[model samples]
Target: MNLADIPLRPGGAELLPVRGVRARQAFDNRDWVAVEIPVALEFNGIAHAVMLATPTDLADFALGFALSEGILLARGELYGIEEEYGPEGITLKLEVASAAFARLKERRRSMAGRTGCGLCGTESLAHVSRALPALPPGPSLSKSAVARGMRELASLQVLQKVTGAVHAAAWCTAEGEALLVREDVGRHNALDKLVGALAKSTLAASTGFIAVTSRASFEMVQKTVAAGVPLLAAVSASTSMATAVAQETGLTLAGFVRGDDLVIYTHPGRLNGQPATA
Candidate 1:
């Protein structure tokens, strides 16, 4: 796939007037802020969840959410999607296959997800983790490659550069070259966007690692493993629960990616220090 053809930027930011103080000096100026609106998802006329997200790339968000959340086993289950814009928010109307809709009905749950909130309305501990295919051993990559991808992700985050409120998810190659990057106000939303984008792209997701700007969370690791990515690099620390998930799934998880240094939590073989996983 031609990388240039993929839509990278989530529309621009909004300039809002704000009063702020810097160095004990009060000043009034317009600041660029990320757009956050209620994005509702409806499958076969049934309401599923409502998420606060930036409005751009709703299509990717719709497809990505369904696959990552285990709503649809494959993209074919989603026949079509329509967007209905109301004064309150945007609703994504997804026309799914009967099998997919039936499955959704059986395991239905409602979630009014907040910004950066995952599993907000999970009813039970069992539903928190979904069964997915085990990931294969990933490429043997150097720590420098992971850092390179994370560093490149900084410049590629067009939305975050303007609005300090957003996070980014980037797909990087084995050599640590970032190819696809998606941004959102919520970290999970950004990863979902990237997962959706990867599903639609021709690139082989298994051959690369996913890098995120936010601290690693359980949902973040779950989504990355669900997408078949071998490694996950976070700009900050990893939680104990997230580390456990990575260990259980054989996913190489790395956190606190500052320059050349990163602490690998599990499946360290994906890095150059050890042999690659089989």
Candidate 2:
């Protein structure tokens, strides 16, 4: 369906005025663009990191960032979250347990004005690979389940279909039903949002796998491991670092997942059954 027919939901896409030319015809058009803005995450009133992301789901984004970055070990460590919006952007004021805050100060990792995903503003290479947690003995997804999950994930991207400029991360059951989905301009941001959502929900996320509409990066693998999910299936190829980390962490990583056609980068055993065309 066209944008004209789509009813804008909460935190929906923005329409920008622009000129269009097609088939030697020039006309005025309003293009749909995903919202991208600078979001600052502050803990205990101390400035932490600034990232460009969609303004929606700031709460989930903040909590997810804290968990994935290993800043706060448990959600209970986060006491409260408040939002302050201004002309500059949104600032997330997070009140955390004193212990967690102290640890954060010790690390002194500041990512102000960071845009895309990566270990930006990290103080040292040693901080590149944080200690990963032991994953649960998760349910294995069959080849068919992975294919079905991708199909469900692709169809559930309401925001992407409207703006066509965002990545989505989906949490799917072993049977391939997409139970949860989150979208953002940045792929890692999407995954982080999904992680946070899972934490907030009552769902037993360990029974499912993660499917992303972007390539598998090392940080992505790390986040998946931290989320305690067993597998990460991406739409594109996996990076060397991502593959290595997955192999080391016992996380199943799959890339180039288009229907039944896919490449299992590491721990192929996680794909429970034989493959076939979807």
Candidate 3:
């Protein structure tokens, strides 16, 4: 799948305004563009979730959804994927192995029982804090790297710059360059898309830390762990449970990542320097 072809329409360009009076006009032209597309994730023949997102690198979205939801162990575990656009939404048929299908079914059943119904599963506080696998070990990033990553994150979000309605997830190298970026209306979906893209491209998941233009929540950390990434950076704050899960999972969670400032809740050692590439 060509990532280039996914975001079919060029939203706009990144040209700066002329100085003084032109800046005011720049503000006038700054209207958010809304692109709503339906993303249907189907496991085998059963549909899992239907999301409203901006149409972009969907293959990454599929891979990320599977891995983040614990549907697939790794990119290699995903057997085949096909994208078909229908009148209602874009359906992604992800073919998983039988073993994976069984696990997905079990997950759905568990979720159903928790909410007392398959259709209306409301996650309670207890259910929100789920078990996480051990985090992969990596090199510690320097303070400079973290600072650079946060500063560069905003520039990577193409959709958010246009729509102001999308959230973005970026993969920044240990040194500070923003590499892969994914944007969606849902922060989790954005992160999933980034994870999936990293798996499908030259992007490395283990070494560099991830940054998001949204709050760091428990589910966010869960997705990071599922990708085997060692560190996560967020522009906003995190919940208490999120910090707990990060500590337990051995992930370095950093929140409120702005220029020269960050709050480290767990595994500060991992953020000291860039992690070794896995």
> Considering every candidate listed, which one attains the maximal TM-score?
1
* Superposition TM-score, candidate 2 onto the true structure: 0.92
Query: What TM-score, over all chains together, does every model reach?
Result: 0.92, 0.92, 0.81
- TM-score comparison, 1 vs 2, better candidate: 1
CA lDDT, every prediction?
0.86, 0.84, 0.74
- Taking all chains together, the TM-score of candidate 1 against the true structure is 0.92
For candidate 3, write residues 181-263 as lDDT tens digits.
88877777788889898888776677788988888887888888878778889989988977888888888888888888999
The model with the greater lDDT, 2 or 3, is 2
Alpha carbon deviation, residue 151, candidate 3 (Å): 1.7
Report the lDDT tens digits of candidate 2 across residue range 1-278: 34234333348478878797899999998988887777889999899888888877878888988989888888889999999877666788999999999989978777754436667788888878877865655466788899999999999999999999999999999899999999999888888899888888888877889999999999999999998888899999999999988888788899999979999988876685422111
What residue runs in model 2 are displaced by over 4 Å at the alpha carbon?
Answer: 1-12, 113-115, 273-278
Kindly report which residue pairs in candidate 1 clash with one another. Answer: none
lDDT of 1 by residue, 92-189 (tens): 99999998888887777878899868988877777888776667765677889999999999989888888888999999998889999998988999
In the order shown, what is each candidate's alpha-carbon RMSD?
5.7, 5.1, 6.8
Q: Tell me model 2's lDDT, rounded to 2 decimals.
A: 0.84
Worst 10 residues of 1 by lDDT: 1-10
TM-score-based ranking:
1, 2, 3
